[model samples]
Target: MASHLDLEEQEQLEQVKAFWKQWGNLITWLITAVLLAYAGWQGWNYYQRQEAAKAAAMYDALDQAVQAADADKAASVFNDLRERYAGTVYAAQGALQAAKVQQDKGQADKAMASLTWAADNASDDSYRDIARLRLAGLQIDAKQYDAAAKSLDAIKSADFAALASDRRGDLLLLQNKPAEARAEFQKALAAMDKTLDYRRLIEAKLATLGVAVPADDAASGAAK
Candidate 1:
């Protein structure tokens, strides 16, 4: 009976060995892959948090510089943000603020550069749209009328369609094309929300161009 028990135990051990030979490597590899993937995911999350924290600190510095009227320091910090954290929303916001500062200081070229960077490199669509609109405004100020028209035309966001049309009218008016401006203003009026005070401003613009906004439309706009 003892001999039989020993044989049974030995058989069980051999069977276990055979199973390991057949599938052990696969099982080990699967566990290893899972562990590595989990580690990588954890590492990625950590890296993103670090990046966000760094970006936030830099943006704070940039904001302080802007508030202090230190254009050089603001530009330096913004350039750092552009180079180091361009993928962050903070960088885009910094660019917008930097552009405003430059514009206030009459540094049109610098403002254009900052706005161009935001328009080209911002990760968010809305930020890019805002940058493009501001860039178009700067282009209009620079007497780059054709470029402003093209810039306004290239805005693809449906949310900004009315504003783009209004900007296009501004470009046309600057070009002394009142008829085209009036038409664009009408399109803007059509696209804008009736309840927006901005719509009334557009109507006033049309009036200034000697185009009467229909009384019915005005009443509808007012009622809303």
Candidate 2:
């Protein structure tokens, strides 16, 4: 009976060895792959956190420069942020703020440069739109009618449909095309949100062209 039990135990051990020989390498490789994947994930998370912290610091500097109305410092910081952390949203925002400060400081050319960079490099479409709109406004001020038109035309997003039409109207009006301006302004009025006070401004533009907006339009309500 003791020999019988011994033989049974030996047979069980042999079966275990056979299973290991068949699947041991595969199990080991799978475990190694899992461990490597986990380590890579952890490392990526750590790197992203470090990058975000650094970007946040730079953004704070940009904000301070903007608040102090230091155009040169703002431009310098903005350039640094864009060069080092252009992937961050802060780079686009910093460019916008820097452009404003620089423009206010009689650095119109520099401001346009910053605005152009923001318009071209912003990861977010809305930020790009904002940059392009402001750039168009500046171009209009500089009597760059054709460039302004091109900028407005580049804006393809529907989110800015009303604003783009309004700006186009302004450009046409500046170019002494009153009829075209009137049409664009009317289009702007139609596209604008009824609740926005900005819609009233479009209505006023239409009125300037002797085009009466509908009585139910936000323009009439604002007048009342």
Candidate 3:
């Protein structure tokens, strides 16, 4: 009986060894692959954090230039930040701020350039939308109607539908297309939140077109 038990144990050990011989290399490779992937993920996260830190510092410098009313310096820093860190949220924000500074300084071309860049290259959709909206408004002021139309047409988000319609209505009115403007103003009013003060502005626009807001719509849009 002792000899028989010893033989059984030896057979079991041999079976285990055979199994290991067949699968050991695959198992080892799988574990190595998993460890390497984990390491790569960690490295990517670290790289992103470092980039954000550097971008934040650069954005702060741009903000200081803006606060000092140094348009040239602000533009310079903004160009540098955008070129180096265009993937960062800070670059988009800096573009918006730089555009504001340029606009305040009566640098219409520079403002438009910043806005155009943000519209085209902003990392965030909302930032891009904002840039497009502002760019359209400036283009309208400059009587670049075709460019304004193109910008307005590019706005795809439903959240900005009301504002886009309102701007389009303004553009139509400027071009003496009151009928078209009236339709757009109605769309703006319909899309806008009832509680917003801006809805009143849309109502006023409709009034200019000799159209009155429906009684129910007007009541809903009134202040609570």
Quote each prediction's TM-score: 0.90, 0.89, 0.91
lDDT to native, each model? 0.92, 0.91, 0.95
Better of 1 and 2 by lDDT: 1
* Span of 10 residues, lowest total lDDT, candidate 1: 146-155
Please tell me which model should have the higher lDDT, number 1 or number 3: 3
Task: Tell me the spans in candidate 2 whose CA falls farther than 4 Å from its real position.
Answer: 1-12, 219-224
lDDT of 1 by residue, 1-224 (tens): 99999999999999999999999999999999999999999999999999999999999999998998787888999999989999999999999999988888899999999999998889998888889899999999999988777778778998999999999999999888999999999999999888777888999999998888888889878886
Query: What ranking of all candidate models by TM-score puts the best one first?
Result: 3, 1, 2
TM-score of candidate 1 relative to the true fold? 0.90
- Candidate ranking under lDDT, highest first, comes to 3, 1, 2
Candidate 2: lDDT over CA atoms?
0.91
Cα deviation at 87, candidate 2, in Å, is: 0.4
Best by lDDT: 3
For model 3, which pairs clash?
none
Instruction: Please give the range of 10 consecutive residues that has the lowest summed lDDT in model 2.
Output: 215-224
Off by over 4 Å in 3: 1-5
lDDT string for model 3 (1-224, tens) is: 99999999999999989998999899999999999999999999999999999999999999999999889999999999999999999999999999999999999999999999999999999999999999999999999999999999999999999999999999999999999999999999989998888998999989978998888878887855
Of the candidates numbered 2 and 3, which has the greater lDDT value?
A: 3
